[model samples]
Target: MTVYALETSGLTKQFAGFTAVSDVGLRVRRHTIHGLIGPNGAGKSTCFNLLTKFLAPTRGTILYEGADISRAGPAEVARMGLARSFQISAVFPHLTALENVRAALQRRRGESFDFWRSDRILKRYDADARALMAEVGLTGWEETLAGEMPYGRKRALELATTLALAPKMLLLDEPLAGLGQEDVGRIAALIKRAAEGRTVLMVEHNLNVVASLCDVITVLTRGKILAEGDYAAVSANPAVQQAYLGEMAEPAHV
Candidate 1:
């Protein structure tokens, strides 16, 4: 049996009178790309937050490498190698791409963000910062301010920063949310490369992208698991097809 990198049993979240996620169990294997997808209100985001420890679950046990982390805090989970990216860009707009990546590298090295540090202390991180920027295909734009970069590049920079953490499991919430058709492919390729030795669990709306990148997919609908399988199996599911009607175009079907 393959030991999963992450797992959830009876995962659930309740907000007042409504249940956002109910009795959800997920088994994300090691070093594979897995996707969570559904319609607008399918509790994808809620489940994501639960796994990332952004929100405490009302009831559930989250296991990471066989350890229960349901009670772990966000920072704890991050330090434990579970990192997440938000839907909105998470870069510092004023910082140059190199500077932004250098800062993240510095943080990972246990350096405080104290601005009083000398140039020598900061320069120590430059080489690695440059390599990370290049890893995300931001090599030539190193000196540009993050805000000045185009939207796609900005998203890449955000991903570069996330990579600085060197997480074992990465959670991306709508990684391709806002981009042109062109940028979508670029980011998708980047994601595939980033998943080389890490487990990635993503919540994405673009079914085509999901189809191409995901080794396995779990579909949620109305806060429940509608289907789970490879892209072809899930896409062929009658219930999944019915649930997606009107929510997404028919061409998105696999």
Candidate 2:
């Protein structure tokens, strides 16, 4: 049996009387890119929140590398090497790309905020931050404010900041949500490069990106698992096609 990097059994979440996620099981292999997809309101986001500990699970367990973390809070989970992106806007708009990554590194070290400090302490993070920025393909944009960057580059900056945390697994909620075709391709490549030697589980609506990039795809519908397989297998599933892809395939009337 292959040891999974992240696993969940009977994971569930309920808000008031409505169940957002119900009895879902997931097994994501180490160093692999996995895709979670569903129609709007399919509980994909809720599942992500639960995994990252943003929302406590009302029932079930979550295991990261075989350790149960069902009740762990967000900060606890993050300390355990699971990092989430795009949840709270990881990048600071006012800071330069390099500064944003430096800040994340500072936080990772549990460094206290010292408003009186000069660049001396901040300079120590510069080397590491610059390396991270280069890794995310933002080498020359170091001086540019994150907010001033192009839309796609800003997303890349956000990714660099997340990497400063040195996570074992990355939970990306819609990494490819907003972008033109060119940016889509660039970000896709960047994601593939970033997934090297780490586990990546993303919730994306772009089936093409998921189909092309993910090794395993899990389909969710109405708060339950509809299917789990490779892109080919899931795409060929008639039930999946009917429930999801069929809607995409329907032609607009002339």
lDDT (CA) for every model shown? 0.90, 0.87
Highest lDDT against the true fold, candidate:
1
**Cα deviation of 28, candidate 2, in Å:** 0.8
Q: Model 1 segments beyond 4 Å from truth?
A: 246-254
lDDT digits (tens) for residues 184-207 of candidate 2: 888888899989999999999887
Best by TM-score: 1
Cα lDDT tens digits for candidate 1, 1-254: 35799999999999997999999999999999999999889999999999999899999899998889999999888888889999998998888999898888877777777556888978888899999999999989999999899999988998999999888999998999889988999999999999999999999988889999999999998888989999878887888888988443343543
Q: After superposition, how far is residue 217 of candidate 2 from its true place, in Å?
A: 0.4
Q: Candidate 2: RMSD over Cα atoms?
A: 3.2
